[model samples]
Target chain A: MNKTVNQKAWFLVLPVFVVVAFSAIVPLMTVVNYSVQDTFGNNQFFWNGVGWFQELLDPSTELGGRFFDALWRNLAFSAVILAIEIPLGIVVALSMPRHGWTVAFSLVVMALPLLIPWNVVGTIWQVFARGDIGLLGWVVNHLGVAYNYVLDPASAWITIVVMDVWHWTSLVALLCYAGLKSIPDAYYQAARIDGASRLAVFTTIQLPKMRRVLLIAVLLRFMDSFMIYTEPFVLTGGGPGNATTYVSIDLVKLALGQFDLGKAAAMSIVYNLVILAVCWVFYTVMVNADAEKKEVEA
Target chain B: MARIVLDELAHSYKPGPKGPQDYALKRIDHVWRQGGAYALLGPSGCGKTTLLNIISGLVVPTEGRILFDDRDVTRLPTEARNIAQVFQFPVVYDTMTVRENLAFPLKNRRVEASVVRRRVEEIARLLGLSRVLDRRANNLTADMKQKISLGRGLVRPDVAAILFDEPLTVIDPHLKWQLRSTLKEIHRELDLTMIYVTHDQTEALTFADEVVVMYDGAVVQTGTPDALFERPEHTFVGHFIGSPGMNVLPCTVEGTTARVDGQTIPLAGAYPDLPQGRRIELGVRPEFTTLAAKGAGLPVRVKRIDDLGRVRIARVDLGGRPFAATVPEGVAVDGDEASVILDPTRVHIYADGHLVAALPAGATAA
Candidate 1:
């Protein structure tokens, strides 16, 4: 076969450029402009290059301290959610019915939380955890825990963690379930003949087979929980002081509430960079882990 | 090694199967004697794998008991049965090295570390897998992975029997013969009762001391490979075993004389009594048939001749039905009119598709 080169094919890429310009490039360029210049009143702008970024990084100024505090808070939340969800998801997946109508029934039930919009989820939890008007808050108070999610930082944190776990653990479970289903019956039969204990079969066969899916679940949960905004905002409204204000919530307060465009734009750029950098690092680790897995399979 | 006996074994996928067609395996009473190499030969859906799983205690027969050396173990689980089985596909732990996979069975049973290591190395050597023992299992070819499966089954010192469920189905064509020979060698060295199941006649015949031919959920015959070829007890066996299969023609029998398609067929032995109201046929292998003069036997229209390196097969039409006769080299089948002469000694009479008896060549027709 002879190769034919056509320059006309480049026009086929026109729609993609148009979509990217409107959706991403234009908005990003606006943020870049806002980060470097101070704007006051209607359409008046003055240069303030790199000053906002320096203040944001110093952690001594009010803006800098708030940014670092929220950053740390986001990191801690991501870590705690990952620790609970991964194992719980795996257990739920392992115990789920392997065949027939029960599989479909359970899957739909598990996915119910995910189907609700994020703000709806937050509102539902907020009303559901009210000490005076809610079932769970009343039940917990009856048990003598003095629980009130609205009035204390500890109670608010607990509600947020529980709410997040309830909303997202199913995604991890579904991924793990799919991984488990892909293993053939032949492996189980072979393991039985080999006299493998149930634990041995799980550790050596099931765990190793589930490695790829577990990596995906971890990365999704990590990124999603780290940047959580709407749920916490609706439920706690960054309540009982700044306890539950994750970085996205803090960015919203600075940019929209205070109208500090220069500082907010610089913060948002650094926040997006952090997310991109963390995701890139995780993706590289996953890729290298896959290569190492292939070597083991070799 | 133990003599595995299945007494009145029957299985049905549906509970309370109401009819014969519902049974996956019709009731069967059979024995695989200690250290005997046997092959269960059948096409797909013939219940060979079901029977093998039963012996290994993977499947519990609905209506019968299985015994190992006279001890009833029909209700025992597969783990307590101490039997091994290799499946149709090569299954190995993809994450483990080949050595680790082979050692896995022993380690699971809590065998001493040194012993597990030694046995794994020994089995790996026997399988020609020692060179890649440290390599991961998923990196190997289909045949090599199957060999790892085989090695795992053989690693246990106290295994009652090792069953193969078409273990070489995925192996390459040229490698199948080599693996068959290796299985035979393993059987001989270990003196373990092994039952290999396959739909292929060549694989069954070449790999076993005796072949049990099954059709429609029943064992039709159990005999040595040569005996199966020479005298298949059922028409299905005669039809299934041969390359071109045995030529079966509708016949009526009385005493030592049989009439097929209005032609007299001589019998070597007398069958004094035969049941009535069932189909009767005479079966003769192509190797036992020879061409004769036009008036000597039934005349056939020569349709086609296949030159198969060693011998030419003459396919002829007998009353519009296809019949074949093997012709040795140098015997010409040129004439349009060809008569088929079946050797009396190699002739068999079947009633209702079941064998009545075989007649030797020298017996009188009358």
Candidate 2:
């Protein structure tokens, strides 16, 4: 084949560049503008020169302490959600009916929690976990456990974690179910012919085949749990003395509640960078493992 | 090692079957002799795979019992039945190395580590996978992966039988012959009863000791390749087994001679007292049917002659029915002036598409 270079292809891609400049680039530039400068009323702005960033980074400063606390809370929340969801999802996916009318019924049922609006999930849990009027609240109180989500930090954390689990476990389960469904029956048949036990079949055939889907599940759950806002906001409102004020909730409190735009923008950049860095590390490790495996195969 | 027997085995994928078409395998009673290689030759949807699955115990027949030697194993699971099956597609444990894949069954059965190692090494060497023993099984090409699948079956020498269900379909065309020959060699060395299923006649004929021809979910004929070629019991077998197949022409049979559109052909053996309402036909191989001088035999209009180097295949029309005659290169056909004469020794009379007359012991001339 002879090579023919064409410059006119740039005309085809011009619209996508213009769209990205408007939608993503302009807003990001606004964030960059806010992060570097201090603004007092009437659109008056002055350069702060990384002062907000330094304050946000230092644990000694009040602002930095609060930011660190929220960041760690976000990390812990993501960790807990992943630990609970991945295995629970795998089990649910495995136990779901593999074929027939029951599969459709079960899939619709599993998707129910996900279909509910985020704030609605919070409101539902808020009413459902009340210490007085709510059924769950009354039952727990009557059982003498003294459960109170609005007042107690522990109960608030438990309530939010349970709410998140109930809201998002279905996503993980659906992904794993798709993974399980993709495995060919011949693998299982061969396992049976090999006299493999149930656990052996799962470990040798099913689990390995599900690896790629599980990676996607982990990445999705990690990012979603870290950026969580509405459900927890509506549920706890960051109450019980900041016990569950994740970085996003704290950033919202700073930017909108106190109107600290510079501090909030600085925190936003740090939060995004943290997520990007962590996710990048994760993505690289997984991709390199896949590539090396392919090399061995080649 | 075991003489696998199917005693009146029938399977219907549908429940509450009403007619013969409902059954995937309809009441097949056959015995595969111990340590013999057999090929189940059939077109797709002819229940060859169903029968293989029954023998492997992957599928339990809806009717009848299977026996391994003397013990009835109808309800036994595939593992308990101790059979290996290489499927149509290559299946390998993606995470395991080639050696581990071969050793998987032995390890699952709790074979000692030393023995498993020895057996894995032996099988790997035999399969020409010794260099790739450490490579991941899933990383290999299709042919190599298929070899690993075969090696997995070959590693376990104690298995009663090994069933291959079109295992070579994914293989590259040039490698198919080599892989088939490898399978044949493995079968020769191992004492396992092997039943290979394929729709390709050449693959079946080249691989097995006896070929079992199936049609419409029924076992039509079971014979050696020579028997299948020379004396196909059913017309389906006659049409299926050979290149260009045997020509079956509707005929009127009266006593020892059969007539096709006023052209008479003598039968080598008498088909006396054929049943009423049965359609009589004459079946003869294309190789045995010759083109004689015009007006001396069944007058045919020569349509085409394909010169295949060593022999010429003359395509002719006999009384408006297409016929094929394989003739030596020396024999030339004059266009539009051809007549075909089927060799009496090779010709067989059929009653209602079933072979009625078998070639007699000492018949030399037509």
Query: Where in model 2 is the C-alpha error above 4 Å?
Result: A1-17, B358-366
Native contacts present in candidate 1, fraction: 0.67
Steric clash pairs (candidate 1): B345-B360, B345-B361
lDDT of 1: 0.89
lDDT of 2 at B196: 92
Model 1: docking quality category: medium
Report the lDDT of model 1 for residue A194. 88
Candidate 1, residue A188: lDDT: 86
DockQ, candidate no. 2: 0.72
- What's the TM-score of every candidate structure? 0.93, 0.94
Interface root-mean-square deviation of model 2 in angstroms is 1.2
